[model samples]
Target chain A: MNQDWTVIDGLQYSAWSREIFEQMHEGGLTCVHVTIAYHENTRETLTRIGEWNQRFESMPELIRPVYEPSDIALAKAEGRIGIIFGAQNCSPIEDEIRLVEVMRRLGLMIMQLTYNNQSLLACGCYEDEDSGLTRFGKQVIKEMNRVGMVIDMSHSAERSTLEAIDYSERPVIVSHANPSHFHPALRNKSNKVIDAIAANEGILGFSLYPFHLKNGPKCTLDDFCDMVVWTAERMGIDRIGLGSDLCQSQPTTVLEWMRNGRWSKTMDYGEGSSSNSGWPDSLSWFGDNRDFPGIADALSKRGFSDGELSQIMGGNWVSLLNRAATPASPFLQHP
Target chain B: MNQDWTVIDGLQYSAWSREIFEQMHEGGLTCVHVTIAYHENTRETLTRIGEWNQRFESMPELIRPVYEPSDIALAKAEGRIGIIFGAQNCSPIEDEIRLVEVMRRLGLMIMQLTYNNQSLLACGCYEDEDSGLTRFGKQVIKEMNRVGMVIDMSHSAERSTLEAIDYSERPVIVSHANPSHFHPALRNKSNKVIDAIAANEGILGFSLYPFHLKNGPKCTLDDFCDMVVWTAERMGIDRIGLGSDLCQSQPTTVLEWMRNGRWSKTMDYGEGSSSNSGWPDSLSWFGDNRDFPGIADALSKRGFSDGELSQIMGGNWVSLLNRAATPASPFLQHP
Candidate 1:
């Protein structure tokens, strides 16, 4: 195995234009999870999946949608970069119960239940309360399981998230979350949830979302390295991986949407008027100073062995996804 | 009191479109939730919202977004219909926690945490085991609380939803759900969840999701009314309301999304996915068809008073939203 692994970003919202893809390639991003919608650009908010797909047909090699659980592996085996067209928001599925099948066919593997506020499935960490999953949400979970979609509760509400962890037949993933146990906030997972997911055969993607870091924008590779180390001790190397919510190309209407609960129609911000939500100042730039590329260097600097670093980068996510795809997943229960 | 009470559908995503909305207006639908995302037509969604708002904006006397919790009252007082913009999916919020407040400020209220699958905050009910809420999901809830956004856990995972109910400082809402006791499925709420939400001063908007009903398309308003009655008896009048996901203008695409886990990457239909997730096959339409609108007439016909009708129609949701909007709600334990 190559000591210098070609890493896959667990989650990202950077523009998928050819130029940006090129930048990602330059940055050694072998795979990337592209976010499709938030509240700002919901399925009803936009009108062009067909158009988007047609565009993808133009660049089959550079970027395309992944449907099969094996597609990621196929891409890797073929020595090509992989792209997972994921929805940061569930708005695209709209009200259809069966759309999960269509999405899985379309190659959407990881999914976050609630972006910021409440949805049909569950509450957002940004929701007024951490009420667990809703009645309809439970049905949704079953469907995802039936289709082998990895359940991601990264941006979900605490109540709903813990509920999801317990509810999933397989171990659930946090795809992109920090540990509040490390950096206290609504965006990070608790130590209890982290360990619980691990015990259940789920994976946790350590995110470089600066907001959850103990040191905000001023944070350095050292701080990031420390996070990986902290998580390693808690969740072990096998259940950890990379999930970078890299929102490169700011000033794109997306940020405004993101700033305004683009993920859901819920945020903790008051209901008065439009204003900037407080974020960690001096954070790493997605295309420029990502600070941690796939977390390989950071983990190594933190003294992780090559074996551990491999798992933190992508192996863990792949293993979890593959397990979820297995036929026996249906019988999985909390261990 | 004009016994011909004006009515508005809370949340629905049927084969909606220009023709459907017209049917709704002709059918005495003062206003409808008009799901924008379920159909995969965001542009058309805005077109519908704009058209509806334009048609009724000036007729603010006839149609308007239920801005304030009391806006429903205002709509009722003015002999107008009310439209509440709620997302079956929090896809719009994307990943920004602050956007929840932004969406609320934009007059978007009643956001769900996830759509049919897992999202950032919590897991959907369709999930296999049902982990509650994620840590980030917890933050999303707190933010939604500070901003006075109502938590709707209709589609959330059971554990996450319960956690949200327990964590919320404000009353939450299961905008549309059936009781599992009446019919077991991820679409229906359990006795424990139903009772807990109410005990916390929340409300359950009994849905006419059609799929959630005990009967199929052959069911009538009487069956719908019975579900409402069942809900009232089990939960209490104060916590009951009309969430009748009375979708009309929704398109087949919307239906398709509902059929599959549209927003979710896979079909997360939970236990019901294989056996239909336990949602009742028989669907009842709104109005006298399902004997839904006739609920009041039937109740009155059955010797129930007007007070109860008022409570079921809009009073319950109104009160719950009001409590949620309260800066110092008596129900809140955290704040």
Candidate 2:
């Protein structure tokens, strides 16, 4: 990996601690979009934000909050990692549509309309049918655009993902998902969905989550880099970045909550068989915050130029964020 | 009108006051299912219940809490109207399935799965397509059945309603909706839905809301009684009772909240024209809680025998409540 290049993981929900924050700084990660909510409601989300606030106060030299795209550059200059808050589900806003602005004001920069089940906003990937964006969902997308929150469709259904890209005035993103053509996990995006996002000038963050990789935990870096190159050919190198959907050091119960939440009384072994409900073993080459170099080295061996590698490393994500994290977009202002 | 009839209104969400409580006693309404939530989350719902607790304490002579079906008889014996708390939407439980039992413990006896939009439990009548019960919805139905909380599908879509009836081990209730065959309103049920509820031995509350009547606000007592006769032909007299979704003395903004509820920034002229967005004029035959005698007289004049008229007025509801309001059912015990 080129040490001069800026790196941003589009999404991560690692078990944050002083050690992890130190590792993030050591790995030269300039920015990371950290998930703050999966199934949390507004009050629970507020509590989580309060916890993050304490972390920021205690470790100012290691991490700082990123409210705007320029803050990522500031973090890189100051030798600290920028922490951008996002939600994997819109449950943080509950049923109130106006809370989109409220969430944005609280620095929630990206929000997925649904997680692993049907939400009031849009259909999730696990739903039996993809009814696409709902009336409430359309309004939410507009408000999110107005308030500069990126519309993330990583866990949304295919029809909903396509519909969101069509409905959103600004570019929508798959903050942490891989191509279904590479690995047919339910969470992976179909080619149609990927093409829609890419054509709309959105970003695709190639996931390193085992289930989303071509051969689960045993996937080789060669296969992974090949998949990325194939995707980049269709989606453009300037649109691809690393998301690494890493869930390091989390308990099996956390996975259960991620899949089931309070929505189900019975177990929902999402993306895994019933007997293999725990988290999959990590790929040998990439396991934690300090593995960006392994991916960069592999991409270089695939005959990518340094400029192209820089674009995939973090330059593309920073450019997309610059365009997306504006409080008032021309499309929304003039539409 | 039979004064001795044990009248139990299946649902009502009026602006409660001393005046309304006085009218309930004046009209000999032995029990009433008062809606406690439209879009309130659990904590908000708890606050509403706390307010009701204060009302019960302050107005002990006029009203009493009814946690069990036998409490209705107890209230009648004490000459006070029994107040049975119900939720117009399942928002009170939010996304937590175990909160079903928590709500039941809080004396929430009846709960509609959806109000006027898609909820986690089921789709509302206003949605474009009814995809029926979700994965969470099936578990919610089972939990509601286990805890003896009556599943009310008054504002739910047809397919979702029918699926709830099919999925529930206990009989479900259409707590406040009429037959579409009578009025052709979108919120009203079709013959298929009515028959399903009837076949399952569930209760159907004939709504006195203007839009549900055959001719809106101008509907005559004769027209209303005739519609009742028509509905009784399909669903036996034993299954029908009054559920006047009366919003007496409430301001237009309250109606707006009921319809929109922060779900949309735009106005939703639910079941009425844009010009008639406010509360409709009360039916001439049934203006307030003191007008139960007028409906009973109209039913008598429509040629129902005294025994049949007694069953229509409230006897059927009380009997249904007796069967429906237990802590646990045998089906759940065995299942």
Candidate 3:
């Protein structure tokens, strides 16, 4: 593994702690886009941010907040993990387009238009019918573009994702999802979606979450690397990076909260059936943040050059952030 | 009556309708600060704003939104009542300091730190302990001042109200509360609070709500005018205006929602007792927006000069808004 490589994970929703921060350091993770909100509203999202604020205050040596692309370099220089805030759902903004700017100012860098259901903005992958973008959704996309919040369509329906990519002036993102050509999972993106993303110069972060993988918990390092290579060949290496979708140290209850939120009255198994409700076992090679070096080694063995490996690891993500996360308006830059 | 005088109601929470809007026209109202949130969170508050948006669209001829003091002048020129959005509680902003600016940008011109109990920002009158201002409250105040959102302490505790007046760079307001000397209701402000407001160049908008009146619904026009005269002598006429806490066509359920919200499992009658757990009867001389002319007539009968009448009726509120509601920072103006 190249020590100089800027290793960035495009998405993670870990039960964050000092141990995990130390693990990130061990993995030489420069920056990690962390989910601060799943179904949390503005106030609840603020509480989550407050919790992260406390973590940053307590563990300043291990981690710092990444407000802009340059912060990743600063974090790498400081030997600390830079955390970029993201929302898995648009719940944090609720129905207000103005909150896109507010959340951006408060350091929310990425937001998915929908999770796994029909949202105010767009239809999710799990919905029966795909409503590409509501009137509010179009307004929100414009606002998100103006404020430089990355529009993530990982959990959104295919039509919505395509519409978003087409509608957004800035490049969109699938912060954490693999290719459906490899896995055939509902959460994974189709070739068309990936090509659209590539055409729009958007990034597609391959998900390592068992449910989004080809062989679930038993997925081999070679197979995952092969999938990455296939995606790179299809979407171009510059438009790809790692988004492990790691849920390190989180309990089953937290998983339930992620899948169900307050929207469901009864159980919603999500990607799992009743018999497989709990989180799947971690893959042998990439169990946690500490396993990133192993992934780099696997990619190297799979014939990726040092330059290509560097881009796959985090360099691509850094470039994407530089392009997609800078505020469009000068006035928004100050606040 | 001086028809040219800009007649502004400092606050109103009527069950707004086209009928009520027509009543406002009849009252010669230039502008009205309407409460859009009591206990609604950020999302729910946005829904309320959405409802008002629909109203604005439907009744463009009757009313227009007042984003700034100048908007009021435009509304008056257009022969329309300017609806200035306000929140009776800090629930809309929740715990985020940044939302103060966001809400302001969305046309929320005023926010009370507390409704009638302890909030995240300050202590309400109903609370046993009056924590003047929480750490978040101070930050919110600064943000509100910077974004040009008026700080209203109409339902706050004595210490909190005084502290807010002292802490805010811009003039604070008690948008709809009578002086405790005139009416000993817990909802009314104390002489200390009123004097502090006057000292800080803040305005006190006398409430027409029966609970804040001398003899409830039986309170005569003369008695109300005398109380106004007395308050003017003490606090200066420039610092007084009408808030007319009129509940026009709202049901008892709406009143209950206002008093109890979701905070209380058991009923909290607020200003009313258990026996009187509903809106107080409307005052004879000032029942609704259409009755403003009678109150002005009563004030005139009480030997108030035409200049004093104009100031008391609405001129003072317009001046107070000009002083308090202009954004402190230039960057916030565009957003």
Candidate 4:
């Protein structure tokens, strides 16, 4: 693995501690997008940001906040990991579109419109009817574009995500979802979704979550790398990167909360028929933050050139964020 | 008309003026539920309340705020109209269920879970699919019950309304919708909804909005009184009252805001095929605040006894509010 590569994981919601921060540093992760809100409102989200401020004050050696694209380089230069904030659901804005800028100013770089349930903004993957981007959803997308917040369609329904890709002025991203062509999971995106993202010059970060893999926890490194190569050949290597939907050291209750916020009382076993309510086991090749090197090694053995492998590892996401995280007042053109 | 009766209109969104207050006083209205929010959020709703505070300060002789059922009597004694604030949608509370108690404390006596669109709480009448009360909706209903904030299902879908009526420990109210059996408007309730309210010892407020009437603006007062008599026969007279969804002296754009808000860019000419996106003509006889006497006179001509007419006019709503507006800490069971 090249130590100088800007290895940025597009999404992660691991239970954070000094140990995980140390692991991120050891894995040569220059930046990581972390989930801040699952089902929290504006005030509650503000409190969470306040807690992050305290953490930043306390953990200067291992981590720092990433509000701008340049912050990743700053973190790398300082020998620390840049922790970028993102939201798994749009509940934080709580029906007000104006809060899109507020969240952006508060260090949110990415936001998913829905998380496995229908939100005011967009239909979730689990909703029976995908009415596409709602009236409010359109308005929010416009505001999110104006604020330069990356729209993540990882958990949105097919119609909603497709419509959002068409409706948004900026390029959208499937921030942390696998291709349905490989796994056919409920949360996975179909080839049509990938084609639309590729057409729109958007990025797709492949998920390392076990349920998204073809063989779940027992998925081999070779098979995983092969899938990546297949996706790259189909969608272009410039549009692919690692999201690694890792959930290290978190309890089962967090998974329950992630799948079933206050929006559902009954446990919604989101994907298949097994009814396993807890988090699925991590894949053997990528169990923790420290396992990125193993994936890089596997990709190298799969005959990807050093430059193409670098793009897949992190350079592609860095390029996407360089265009996304800037203020929308004077936005740069797509590469 | 009997002057001794406590006449309370279940719903109104009048363009507030001293002249309307004078008409309310002249019509012998003791209290009127004035809509303070349609799509406004918590902060905007608080500003509206603050504006009402100023109105109360400046027009003490004309109108006073009604925080409880007893305030109706106080306004009657003072020869002023009692103005009770209510929200037409749950947008004011947003996603935080705890705001239920806060709104109640701020003199919001009634709140509709949905206003012609799907909300975080429940499905509105306009949504294609009605999944019933959401998980958050159920929790908010419980909090509303505990705080004695009346749940108004006027704009909710059938399944959501029925579920709310069944789930609520406190009696729910269809605060401003007519029976769909009489007029099959999208906003009207069916016999099943009316029966549920009647069975729960709740109240049904027959709307006087032209769109809700049998023949729009041309509906005869005799026909209106006949519908009332028919509804009273099905859901006992004790469970029925006048809501009269009046939009007196409001401009056409105000109606646009009420129906569309920031939710839609295109004008949603709701409930009809006609492109007349404005306030429809008020019914022939009942046009404004001064027309309550005409309704009473017409009902009298239709052979309503004095006690029954009085109940239809306002007594039933007063009784309903007496149970609804009090804090649940010391609630009295209904007969």
Candidate 5:
């Protein structure tokens, strides 16, 4: 098993910017799955996504886009942060099915079926009745498989999550969710759902959303590791991984934008207010505490082995990435 | 034409208490389309709805549930407000399609298709794009038509609006939109779209979200009148009406919940610290302003004929209520 000692982030919402790239370099991150959007967007907004790709391409060799699983080795050889751009919401592709490939070419490697709510493709995690995938949502899952983007079901509801996992030829990833066996309400995945994914050999990246933690925002890095360990016990070691959803920079400036609740759009940047009442003093999400090795050290303290350590740190993601990689078939380009 | 005002408030959302009821009695409001989810409670929400029937049924002269057009005249003779008990969002139906009739039989006469963004039935007015109606939404619309509830598309998006309007064998409603001819954007409908409704013999409502006005927060009552006049000229006076969108006692406390960049279930009372710099405001919302009569006066002053004024003020809605009056036939009841 002479694999690269790559630290792959299965999922994160960090700013896909130079500052974050710099932080990834400093944080010992060899790869990161940066979420884009799986929400609604106008055509003009979708075009700007092309502009987003240009920015990813602009980063120094310290970071390069990873499409095929083979790109990981090449990036590791250079000791660069492999930025695997993904969409938190799928609104960028809008209703067009072909843009899936256009996005793949531009390096969108993974996509959640929905964000905090419903999209044309699928139902979200919080929708009351747990609507399975809509007719279009099922199409999206198949397209996700055909295009080889890892299907991330982190924010999708139980029925939708199960349907997506069942529809996907390759196993999907619950890229960032907390164990529902521990807590209930807005941010936890159901146990039945976890068991189903475990059977499918899917990965579950435990989230750091304060609401997902039993201690809420007061949970320390130690509590975060405990959650990881607890989830692993329930969902088998190989089916679990670390997805430290840390952003390199916490814009004290942008918290109000979140209050607008749209998360991405700059509708009222200066006019909104924020209430960070749930933040734990021990936690730091902005650039200062984005240390990858620091998180690894916490997992090690929780009795994680070099194998489990390497798996969560990056290997599992590499394996999943390999499984989801759609070989560039020149013969099937158009027909 | 001696239909002395039945005073059917097309829609109203405010915390219900003995005080609010007294205000309704004071306002000479014979009936109101009161929102169950936005305000009111389970203890007496339906009890209050049933109370309207018992009070009116007992009097056989005053307040009653206006399930048919003929109920208005009879209610006015008795002197009670017709309570069209309903929900602002179908979220309470959660995801069940059968609940449509159970709630309808329980006095849930009108339902806004989607509140502000996405629901199973259609996209909200606030969504970036309307994914049109989902299969469940189509089923819901058909069931609504069958069950005899008026399909209010006031808060729905452009695409969802058109699709729902077309799918519904019964004419639907733009229950609370100002015309783009007044102030164009997401909240206002285009002449073409309004014309489509008129062609279907459906109704268009004038809302008071200040952001949809010419000067937004600076808009005056006269500006509101201008919108009504503009819609009348385009959609015909007979088809135009007032959705007033009045939140009489609550002071528009739910605006924050709507700014979730979409309609949200989580309630955030008070002016939300939101990122909707671009969202519509309430120059017209008057949240707590009971001087809604002033808007009526403005319409009267603007030379809306006493006949035309009466029609726009509430007659058109009465006609829609009559048309949408859950048909009594089994075909109408279970279409």
Candidate 6:
């Protein structure tokens, strides 16, 4: 593996600390999109952003905010990891379409239309029926496009994902999910959804989370690389990248909060059943930010050319951000 | 006196009930701009709006929501009182400019830039050093203009009110503040603020709260009418109307919440001193919504023409709403 190669993780919601920042540097990560909100409303999201602001202030040598696609290159040049803010649910906007521009201006570059239940915008994957894009959902997609905020559908239901691809003028990304062909997890995407994303010039970020991988925590690095190669064949190499969905250093309680937010009073196991209602054991091959080079080595050993390996690792994500994150309207530019 | 006068109160924060709704009808009020939020954040403001939704559902015969200026006329024609929502503080939006449009779309017709203290947007009257408009306040002024939410500067500091009037494209309003020329209360507007509002084609909704009136609760009806006549002389008659600032049937605790909403540890007297901390005694001439007719009668007895009396009663407010509440952008119109 090349030492100077740029690596990017599409999603992470870690119990972040200086140790994690050092590990990201050790892994040769140029950029990482981090979840700042799960089910937070607008003010709570602002507080989360304030926390990130403090993090950037305290660790200027380790990480900086990624306000645009160019910021990733800047971070790479500065030898620091660029942090892109994203929300895993529409709760941050709180049923307001106009908040899309506001959040984008505040440096929130990506937002999911739903989590794992019926949201005001769309139905989530765990719901009984998929209602597709709602009235406000369609409006918000338009606003997000105008404001240069990428629409993410990682936790959305199948119909909503397809409808989002159809409705969005800009590319829509599933920031963290694997192909259901690899592992039939509820959070994984179907071939139809993956194909639609590819058709719309969107990217599918392959997740390394144990629950979404074949054989769970016991899945081999070779099997993961093989799945990636298969996905690249179906949807062009430019349409696939690493997401990882690494929830590093997070306790089981964080997993429970992610699954149950404020919507459920009783316990909701989500991907885990009653017997398995906690964070899964970390994969031995790819555990934390320090393990990216191992995955790169595995992909290279599987006969992927250096260029193909670079695209899979980070170049495709940079390209996706450039293609989708530029503001469509000059009015959206801050004065 | 005509039986079908189109009466309007610029501001009220009553313990709203079906009985109060009936009193509005009995007073021949076509519309009232009611305070829906004071120091409430976005979620709490939404709950307040939801409560109003329930009220509308329960009392369809007595009151209805006024979405546009035309709705006031409709209410008058249908013999129902129209409710126009306003927020006395910037807390409802909570540092997000996009919420100005969202709150407007959710039937919030007006918003004060601040409420008796320095806010994220601007400085309130009670703040010793008025910083005027902050960076967020300038952006919010533009957003409020685009969305047609009337910028109310009644409780804002002098410089902030002047700056808001200058900045807003549409007519600004002091929805509930007496001129300091009448009585020098901390919440009252100065002549410069009043004149700026009038110069910008705005209207000043003269407050009838006892603390804002000369001689407090002992202020005579003739004296109140004389102040109105004097103010109409300083600013044009077209730029003056009644705001009442009536807070009927509310407990003293509600006043405390308004004065020090989670912002202070100790009690803040606001307009009231420590001795008279509770709500000032209701004025004899204007006790509740039912006393609006008495005010009109007093103005009529002061030798004002019937046309001028009609304008002061409600016609000016309807005109002001039509001038300021129409969305500047066609995109802001709901589909």
Best by TM-score: 3
How much does each candidate deviate at the interface, measured as C-alpha RMSD after superposition? Answer: 19.9, 20.8, 8.4, 20.2, 26.1, 12.6
Question: Model 2 over residues B1-335: C-alpha lDDT tens digits?
Answer: 55677887777888899999999888778888899999988767766776776576578888887877778777888888989999999988777765675567567889999997999989999999889999999998987776688899999999999999999988888988889888888899999999999998898899999999887899888888888999888899888988988787887878888898989998899987788877888888888888988888878888899998878778887777766667563211110
- Note each model's CA RMSD in angstroms: 23.6, 19.8, 8.3, 18.0, 22.3, 12.2
lDDT of 2 by residue, A1-335 (tens): 77777899999998899888888877778899999999999767766776676576568878888877878877888887899999999998888766675566567899999997889989999999989899899999988887789999999998888989999988999998999899998999889999999998999999999999988999999999989999999899888998989888889889988999998999999999898889999999998888888788889989999999999989998998877777773211100
Candidate 6 is scored at a TM of 0.58
The worst-scoring run of ten residues by lDDT in candidate 5 chain A lies at: A326-335
DockQ of each: 0.02, 0.01, 0.06, 0.01, 0.01, 0.04
- Per lDDT, the best of the predicted structures is 3
Residue B59 accuracy (lDDT) in model 1: 46
The better candidate by TM-score, 1 or 6, is 6
Per-model CA lDDT versus the true structure: 0.63, 0.84, 0.87, 0.84, 0.65, 0.86
Models 1 onward score TM values of 0.47, 0.51, 0.61, 0.51, 0.46, 0.58
| Count of backbone collisions within predicted model 5 | 23
Model 1: lDDT equals 0.63
Residue range with the least summed lDDT across 10 consecutive positions in model 2 chain A: A326-335
Tens-place lDDT per residue, model 5, B123-163, is: 97766777899999999888777667888877677888888
* Residue-level lDDT tens digits of model 3 in A224-286: 988988888999989999999999999999999999999999999999989999999988888
Clashing pairs for model 3 are none
- Candidate order, lDDT descending: 3, 6, 2, 4, 5, 1
- Listed per model in order, the count of residue pairs whose N, CA or C atoms clash below 3 Å is 179, 0, 0, 0, 23, 0
Kindly state the number of residue pairs that clash in model 6: 0
Model 2 is docked with a DockQ of: 0.01
TM-score of chain B of each: 0.79, 0.96, 0.98, 0.96, 0.80, 0.98
What TM-score would candidate 3 get against the native?
0.61
